[model samples]
Target: MLADTKKVGGFLLLAAALLLNGCKEEKAEVGAAAPALAAYDLQGNPASLEKWQGKHVYLNFWASNCGGCLVEMPVLEKLSKEFGDSIVVVGINTDKEEMNIQALLDERQVSFPNVRDQLAITQERYQVIGTPTAFLIDPQGKLTGQYIGMLHEPELKAIFEKSRQKG
Candidate 1:
């Protein structure tokens, strides 16, 4: 009986380790080039991260059902317009239904270029575990920081400001 108990305990420990590792936070080193991303927007427009080269980019991963994601939209929109020339804010929506994604965009009045990632390909590449995951990439396409969850205006401003200072 004791042997069986020890065996179960070891199995549980190993399972926990694997589960934790799988859900580990995504980290893109500051000096490493951003991961490759290629997908179509809701309008069926092909877009890639390289297209926004030479500019700071806010790569945001979101889902229509995520309330925090909905809250982050306007904040990102404001940043997108305010820093139009200096930065590019790209929203990658992980909604399975393209039509539903469009309706949410229309209702939210979000103007930034939003990529459709129904297959979760981009999310997997970015190692996103939840909604409102944002990465700050510099002009050279190197990642500067990764933010998970809703980000306020000031936080967003600081990221942009830092990138500008570096440039």
Candidate 2:
């Protein structure tokens, strides 16, 4: 009888642990220090979030095939230029084919720096489940906000405003 009671107790503990783990969201925790992204840019130059330590970093994850991702690239590019010195924008392209990515970049005339995540390491590190995911990181590298789906200029500005208001 005691053996059976111990077995039941262990089973209950396992069940409780699973429930707790299940409640956790499958995304980067806001306010946590952002993960360092060490990779090479499309031009074969080294790039990483660690390089932008003193400025707010707009880190966006995108893919060549996603229409929404394509829509937001130009917006990000324009805003990145306008924000200048205050905020730095970086894009992580998840497409396996460099040709497609470069074609899109060329067609769009996007000059903002972007790195390719061919191994999906960047995606996994950031808990990115979809294209067009963006993390607004503070100057100190803390993840201020995570936004999924397409983001326009106004919404991006609002996110910036909110972060400033809270910080």
Candidate 3:
């Protein structure tokens, strides 16, 4: 009985360690290359961070039903227009249904390339816990900022200015 108990305890400890390893935390750290995950944009074109190489990138993770996200979409569009080709504002939509996402986009007139995160893979990689989470990537593709809530033009401008100094 003693030998059986020892074996069972050892097995349980090993199982716990494996489980914890599998749950390893993932977050986009500043000065680290962004995750190179692939997803489709609203136009069904394959999109990834690689496409925005050599450009400043603002990656926003949001969901259609998220209230804060609803307010930030237009702000992002304005940033895209003002920044022009100099910087890229990419939205990662976390909505489960493509149809609903399309409907929201149509209603909002969001002009930026909104990538579909149907499986939430990129969201998980970014450690996004809520809508309107934005990350700033410098020209060299290093993560510079991670904002977990609504972002305004002033704040964005500040981040861009700071990034310019760094790169």
Candidate 4:
């Protein structure tokens, strides 16, 4: 009877370990190849991370209802414009409706490229934990950093500088 009890306990432990391992979420790591993002823009045009393969990419995940996301739109736009052809800023809006995404972009006067992630598939691809999450991919298509919450110019500039040094 004691042997049977020990066998059952061992089985339970093994089962628990398997469950925990399966539940673990995979996240893109710095210095690893960035995961491919395939989605459409608000205009229904195809947009993808692979489109800008040769330039540094500032990929930001956002939502219309998130205040921090709203605040950083203009900042991201500024970065896209400031960097010109060197760095491309791509915003992935995790909102259900196209009209809502458009309205916010129009209101913000955001001219940078933005794609729609209505189902959040792309969000899960990057393992985004929050609305204002962002990933920086170097020109070689390797992830350099991941930022959660709001982002500012100085922080981004510093990150870019660091990435360049490492690259």
TM-scores, all candidates, are 0.78, 0.75, 0.77, 0.76
Better of 1 and 2 by TM-score: 1
Clashes of each: 0, 0, 0, 0
Candidate 1 pairs with clashing backbones: none
Compared with the true structure, model 2 gives a TM-score of: 0.75
Superior candidate under lDDT, 2 versus 3:
2
What candidate 2 gets wrong by more than 4 Å, as runs, is 1-27, 98-100, 161-167
Model 1, which residues run further than 4 Å from truth? 1-28
- For TM-score, the strongest prediction is 1
What is the per-residue lDDT of model 1 for residues 25-122, given as tens digits with 9 covering 90 to 100?
34455568887764687768776888899999989998878898988788888878877878889998887853577777888899888888775656
Error of 4 at 28 (Å): 1.8
Q: lDDT, candidate 4, residue 33?
A: 88
Q: Candidate 3: list runs displaced more than 4 Å.
A: 1-27, 161-167
**C-alpha-based local distance difference test score of model 3:** 0.78
| Candidate 3 local lDDT, 55-112, one digit each (tens) | 8888988887788888878877887887755688888988875457877787889878
Candidate 4 stretches with Cα past 4 Å from truth are 1-27, 161-167
How many residue pairs clash in model 4?
A: 0
Q: Write the per-residue lDDT of candidate 4 for residues 86-158, one digit (tens) a residue.
A: 7778888887864477777888999988898775657777888788999989888899888998877798777
